[model samples]
Target: MKHPVTPDGRYFAVRCRLWRMVNPDLDEAERSKLTKRLMVARRAVRDAKAARDPEAEAVAHRAVDVAKRALGERGPVWWKDGSPDLNRRIAKNTPYADWYAQVTRSRHGGS
Candidate 1:
């Protein structure tokens, strides 16, 4: 499924949050791989927004497809309700809070 995008053109915050959850345990190589995947996905979304390009849309969809497949292949690490855990974890980390705050503030203009 396509990831949800915010009305103001930002990708949903949950996508970033979820992506960060995979960061802690990765080796440098793994982190680089994940970052590259995210960059491709992000660029695809940006391109789609810019011109309604079908190729861009496909790239974004493929990114999610790869992610879901990887998650399934790995088996369940946490339950489906892991969002609460993720939120709590991020809340406890100052860097995460700083990043989240910046993204949110930019997206909503300090609303």
Candidate 2:
């Protein structure tokens, strides 16, 4: 299922917390490439953990970070509006609090 994105399109909410969205400005091809890289790196991480290889796990984690940064999901905020990066913040405690509340209310039939 799709998660709820903030109105400004910079983040999507999962379990009432915000996670930064990818840079929308990236061309589709570039985005796809980075996403694939991220998947591969993620699998590497899993494999390293299962194999109990700490060195390999560290390398894989670095790879994942690189891909995520390239995709604009980590590092710096993709948005240029000067809004602080709220990545991983609880939505209800941030500026998006009212908006998130409204969304959840509507989703639950205005509970």
Candidate 3:
């Protein structure tokens, strides 16, 4: 769950994208809380890197990961009974190959 070192702007962009994906009707307070946590995590990452401390960097990475998970990224899907997560694996390599192809075709009109 360690994210590679990147520009602070990149982290902000990610946070923005995740925020956009959240339910629009979600409680404002809850959304603000998650956004704050994400900012803290990103800062930890930046600070740890500046200090050039590997252990602190790892911890910071974990913090970023934890924040992302809480924000419904890179962890369990928030939606109940949603389709199984295939991660980044190719559909043809998993049992959902056929189903994946069918879904893609329907969604993208087979491009």
Candidate 4:
């Protein structure tokens, strides 16, 4: 269960944080619950790292992933209609590029 120490995990953690800021869909109660779970999982990650326990770290990582997924940061899309994932890249390299650009432009009034 020892997950590799990759920068990807940290990146995901940061993504979870940033996404949470913009995600207003969750009501107060649900948001509170998920926030608590995220805090506990994050603490576990820190503790496991301090103890140098890779297996424990991996388990904690899973917890973190679960928490983030529940917060709609790292898992299946909440919407059912297969809408573009705004959380992903906006580059022309991806299929969502045009849609993403439109959404971004609309949000920013970029014409």
Name the top lDDT candidate: 2
In angstroms, the error of model 3 at 53 is 0.8
Per-residue accuracy of model 1 over 1-111 as CA lDDT, tens digit each: 243322322122463542323423447786667667767776777789788888878879788557633433223443353532332233325334655666666767884
> lDDT tens string, model 3, 3-106?
22112111211211211133333488987898798889889889989999889989989988887777665576555666554444554555545554555566
For each candidate in turn, the TM-score is 0.40, 0.95, 0.53, 0.57
Runs with alpha carbons beyond 4 Å of true place in candidate 4: 1-23, 86-111
Evaluation by lDDT, superior candidate among 2 and 3: 2
lDDT of 4 by residue, 1-104 (tens): 12111121211112112122213477889978998999999999999999999999999999988888887776766655665553444234444345445545
Clashes of 2: 0
Candidate 2 lDDT over 3-88, as tens digits, reads 88998999999999999899999999999999999999999999999999999999999999999999998998888788899899
Model 1 RMSD in angstroms: 10.6
Q: Show where candidate 3 strays beyond 4 Å.
A: 1-20, 23-26, 86-111
**Candidate 2, pairs of clashing residues:** none
Question: lDDT for each of the candidates?
Answer: 0.51, 0.94, 0.56, 0.59
Evaluate model 3: give its lDDT.
0.56
Highest TM-score model number: 2
Task: Find the 10 residues in a row with the least total lDDT in model 2.
Answer: 1-10
- Quality of model 4 by C-alpha lDDT: 0.59
Global local distance difference test of model 2: 0.94
